[model samples]
Target: MNHFFRKPILLITATLFSGSIINAQNVGIGTATPQLGKLEVKGSTGAVSAIFYDQSTGVAIENNHPGIGFNSYYNGGRKAIAPGFGGLLGMDPASGKLHIYTAPASIATAGAPMLLTERMSILANGNVGIGIAAPTAKLDVAGNLKIADGTQGEGKILTSDELGNASWQSGASLVPGASIGYGTWGDCATNGNIGAYQPLTGAAGVNNFGKSVSLSGNYAIVGAPFETVGSNYSQGTASIYRLDGNGWVLMQKLTDATGAAYEHFGSSVAISGQYAHCSYCRRPRRKWRAWFCNHLSIQWQHLAAAKNYANQPCKPGFLWQ
Candidate 1:
């Protein structure tokens, strides 16, 4: 008899459970008639709409929600609304801080569903990241940022004004022959020959002076690769000049100690600090060499001299200063 009564009670419990499942519909937490969604929570002015708590893990999870959660508070008789702001809200189990994420929206169609893009999250450590999953700094952006002010140009720099506003400003000029207001004004062909000085003796076409020139500090070097020395033709020479007061005075003339005919000694010239470098390219013997000069001690030293092998082609060599 006891077993027969227990069987009837089990059948009644199963019938009542199935009925509850069939009658399940939209649930309204604080409203009489909820919206078309599965669940809806409504609040009054100056009041929080909902608060979820999970005592098991100390983290709350809200899924498939629309609109911002904590932005509906009244402020100074004004209601500021943030539209289309919805995401997941959770609490970090370790730090107990809130984490908010903006959820991606979607649109349903007959063929496919299109998802709308949105920002990811604000981390529990207060770091915000855009276009990145993990941010290592305070505000980390993984993409390029372009400032679209009308005053900016190609090579201009971004600068801040006294009012703390940032704008673009012109950078420093870096072009050669830029006049910066510190030179005497006169034409090259008609300068009154104020401080002009040339070789004491040279014919019209033989003197190829000022072919190569280098200036550093107060020193200048000029090369003449076709200047004749004694009876030799094209025995090149170099001249060093110093800036004395407002004029350039010739300090010394440099020539190879064992200079021969057709050796273009001063084809290239460079100066740095108190030293000068000159090159000699001997075309006939296929030989190339460079010499170093110390302007302070008035000493010359042969640094490199190399002769190409017979029947071997050669290219122009470079000398480092």
Candidate 2:
């Protein structure tokens, strides 16, 4: 995060044989005198440097770097041109990572993937990692999956700053300009333009096709509606897909995990680890949106409701073990 602080004034006396008056902006030590705009500082061979500013805008122009300049994307505002950091050139205070999001939004921007968010790609040796990085830190956040630009036009890509000697994996999607989602082992990119999430070909389809998806560890569960999953509501059919490799593998097509699936039942779902809690709300004269937990089993655990659950009357909130 950007920070600005001012230290309180402290006074000290000089016991020098030769002395001169020291101004608030000037200092005199021994036989040396220094000033902000005049006196120079030489660190090494190229240490002594001067910083010039724009007469009109007062922007920094030392060497070839710009710091804290004016911006006009939204309202022609002002932002900082960050120096190199976090393996690249910027750090996102929100996530404490050195990546592109660290760039001020006035420039093109996108949401970075959180830890445990997986991204795949085709590496240089035709393996996986392409012209990017894989999430290798805690939760493994690789800069391979692209951060999507949600605008009608293309969005800016957050490049993979990992300089390594690893081969590429097949279909590694951690490119800089993809949608963002929370599914590792598969594909999930940040839809940069709109900040929306786009999951790759895996367990996400089951969750995204109808209701929202819940993730636990490496597993994600989605409630497949009869309309989306093309299941027979009359026969009470619900499906759950497991994440395998870089794609989704259908685990099973459930029937009556909640004893009997209601017309529009199975709306909201929450997944954790291997547990998936879902709410089933019948349609038309829907009475209640009862919840059930498909604990990776054929049976379902009915959750308590506030009586007469409507269309997703309440979500299934969970606590970690």
Candidate 3:
């Protein structure tokens, strides 16, 4: 009687275990039916689908490659999973580095539809690489980089203002044929003659012409300090030119009526409405003279003259009145 009861109990337990396996068929964590995968979890819109956590210790799931991964069907088809169709975030088992991988949209094998290509990688040393497999620096890029600010173009320069704001601006270039011819007063008056009728024979860079320049309205004054007068060298002079409809035209040449060599009479010049000023500084004695310019006749007249007292030791001055 005991043997008969034991056999029935053991047979009943085996039957119940078999039924439990059949009932547990495809397990769905959040859904009634598990889809193509063995385990399926569905999430609400805008919320995380699933989270894997370990309550025993702080360390969660760890694997050589991706411990958990995902896949989707291709072209909205439900028959088969897409080939090379997803992204994976994982850590290297050896180096302990995090890596982001993606698969191309091409079919390779049904078992392994696509090969995982590392798109971005962060090494254990904290170096990152984009489009580069291995990065040796904090940030490394293997492709071209472009910077745009909406108003930048070729032949422009990046400039910064006083407040440290940066922008692009036009670069400097030469104006097309905008040259102004200038020379010594004696050279223009008598066809380059320095003395009684001697032709000017000075070479380029020898005469310090254009030492001073001033502009007023449509008139411009240029100075030549190394001009020769009679038999003296460096008897400075200034020339005034007017801008007509044609261009810059020679107007008049100005010099001290009683200027001597080494005076540098036109070392500095300034021009205003109808007046012009020129300075002559020769150690121990500084002379400043004002001239009244007649634009109509293109003539210059010495208006007033002042001489600095050597003992006064005043500032190197100019006469404007």
Best by lDDT: 3
TM-score of 2: 0.29
Candidate 1 segments whose C-alpha is farther than 4 A from its true place: 1-186, 189-205, 297-321
Where is model 2 more than 4 Å wrong at Cα? 1-208, 227-237, 257-262, 283-285, 294-321
Candidate that beats the other on TM-score, 2 or 3, i.e. the better one: 3
**TM-score: the better of candidates 1 and 3:** 1
lDDT of 1: 0.55
Order the candidates by lDDT, highest first. 3, 1, 2
Clashing pairs in 3: 192-200
TM-score of 1: 0.35
Give per-residue CA lDDT, model 2, range 243-321, as digits (tens): 4333455555443443343444445557665455545544444444445554525334534443462333333341111
Model 1: residue 185 alpha-carbon error in angstroms: 14
Using TM-score as the measure, name the better of candidate 1 and candidate 2: 1
Clashing residue pairs, backbone N/CA/C < 3 A, model 1: none
In model 2, the Cα lDDT at residue 226 comes to: 45
TM-scores of all candidate predictions against the true structure: 0.35, 0.29, 0.33
Better of 2 and 3 by lDDT: 3
List, residue by residue over 1-321, the lDDT tens digit for candidate 1: 355444444444333221111124766656667655667655543433444433211112222232233222222221213333233344445553444444254213211222223344456777776766566777778888788768777766675522346766554445577543322434322443222333332235675677778988557788887888887688888887765433456778888877788776777898876778788766566476666777544443444444444544334444212
* Candidate 3 Cα RMSD after full superposition onto the native fold (Å): 20.3
